[model samples]
Target: MTTIALSQEQQLALSNLCTNIQLWAKELGFQQIGISDADLSSETERLQQWLGKGYHGSMQWLEDRKKMRLNPELLHPGTRRIISVRMDYLPEGSQQIAILKSPEKAYVSRYALGRDYHKLMRKRLALIAEKIKQDAQAFIPELEISSRPFVDSAPVLERPIAEKAGLGWIGKHTLIINQHAGSWFFLGEIYTSLPLPVTEVITENKCGDCEACLKVCPTAAFPRPYELDARRCISYLTIENKGEIPEEFRTVMGNRVFGCDDCQAICPWNKYAKPTCEADFQPRHGLENSDLLTLFMWDEQTFLKNTEGSAIRRIGYELWQRNLAVGLGNAPANPDIVSALTSRLPQASELVAKHIQWALVQQKNPNRKRVRKLSRTRV
Candidate 1:
């Protein structure tokens, strides 16, 4: 460790600065903020092993930027510390659970129900970075401070960084979890050149003896704790992976038309999750409880307009329709649903048509159960 002599006055000032950062973080809608050093060799090896098992499916990019993901300095030269922050995204009450069990309503992941988090999180991080700069200039003028905000946009090992920063430990489901905040939060980071004090009290893994997330997988995505088979994950199937929907996992998908939250929902730790106070995070376009066929009927223009600022927009209208077709197919069949699928059949692309035809067949035989159990628990 490089020892930089600090007078008692400066030491006290730095302590107060940390306190101020936490308070400002809360004021800016962040649930928590923690600082960590920039070493992630172990995490890099784990990632390589996971990728080696071909768990990433069509997401080959995960294998591309190894160095940047493992070291913040690779992404931003001179980066010496990472400032991680969390923001809770779960909507109030049991809306997500209720929808998941319904089998008729479309279960969009709670995180995607609001405005796109990337922009919102980056905006807040910018403000926080500005605050830190202003304070540091006044108190620690010798520090060559440089900070940049990031939210799921680069090759940052966010979960590992969060763990080192004392935000939480990586759960079996591969999501970061805090004892106080649970796993219902979005993580962002600020890569800073300043050698900030690291949060020492790292969260100890509490997934002991319990594999609720592994057993709850609708597609058996978890090969083991802290390891995920992305090919079997609903979020990957519905959002990231393009092309045909695999037949084996379709029936278990139920009415989840977008991202899935089965693993997070089943984690017992989430009971302590706090609902977000930010109005920007609340559900929009009635997506929290919309029916499968309802969302399925959105025209291309309407889909674009409604999802203008939402993360769902990144999937494009074609995939949106494709996913909705699958959800409608899995829903309890009815004349209305059949008619809707039939009408769209002529207009859909080959990919959408394939899913639409599948939906029509499902409508023809509503009670036809094909592989009813996706997994023992994780759905």
Candidate 2:
């Protein structure tokens, strides 16, 4: 962590490099890029408070990486600045609300419908880092450059860093929301030792007086305006939780089999969300508008092959089936759905079998009401 002294001319050159980095990032398909100092002291107390609340659920990794998350230098020594970038992920013709209202259909989170963003983003960030390294070396040939690229794979406090980088502000739902781009985007970062000039203009939080995201949450995950109770979050239950989904959340989970998007979907700013130009993010395997029964019928091999390179693959077949079972249960009961759930009961894992049994009960009970209110036709 030794400080490298630079002359005034060298500092000006480094600042100019920052401008070139932004242009290079755009060439690499990033929608926006900004620079921020690697000081996260402002967020340390907030992280501790969130962890103290035990809101992280079974994700023990968050706790394990708390120190590094708050201090980038601890995670990557010599890190002096962070290059934050955002890439739009929303696909065109996303039938988000349509699929949600159609109980028979499965509502995979839009972000997971395509290839996993980690690899794509990481590769792009690495290239950006390499370009920066080359440029910095050209500016100061004797200067040693150190940089690391990160997607969601690392315990990086990306949302807060992006905010400080002037990318966007953390919305009420705890996701970064750009005034123009909304929240349908993925964030990536490059931790670098180079003395790049940081962005001075921090994006202001524009979510004033709008509680639409909080109210639309099926699980009421937000206990307040800015805090989230991950234990009660449908996204965490469906994607991160390794065991059975709690009975309380099962019925209200609706047809969202992968991750929930109610908060972002209801946010008014999303009207400005432009469709992603990246082909890698386009929905694959018809997952954007798939049926619960259709996905439920995917055997382990089929599931693996279909979800290859996709984010949904990480959940594995058991959780995949388990999530679809919950979705099917919330669906309007159909003879086909009932038969499908009953047939899978014998082969299902102990965890999935229990969910299938619960789904069977829900399918048979005619008095059960759909938890989701159908109105909008897109997210």
Which candidate's TM-score is highest? 2
Task: Write model 1 residue lDDT over 200-314, tens digit each, in one string.
Answer: 6847899889988888778888867778888988899999978988988888888888888888888899889999887878899999989888888999999999998999999
Flag clash pairs in model 2: none
| Candidate lDDT values, in order | 0.86, 0.90
In angstroms, how far off is 26's CA in candidate 1? 1.3
Scored by lDDT, model 1 comes in at: 0.86
Tell me the tens digit of each residue's lDDT in model 2 across 223-312: 888898899888999999999999988888888899999999989999999999989899999998888899999999999999999999
lDDT of 2 at 168: 88
Model 1 alpha-carbon drift over 4 Å, by segment:
1-9, 375-379
Which whole-number lDDT from 0 to 100 does residue 189 have in model 2? 94
Give the runs in model 2 whose Cα sits over 4 Å from its true position: 373-379
Clashing pairs in 1: 215-377, 216-377, 216-378, 217-377, 217-378, 218-378, 218-379
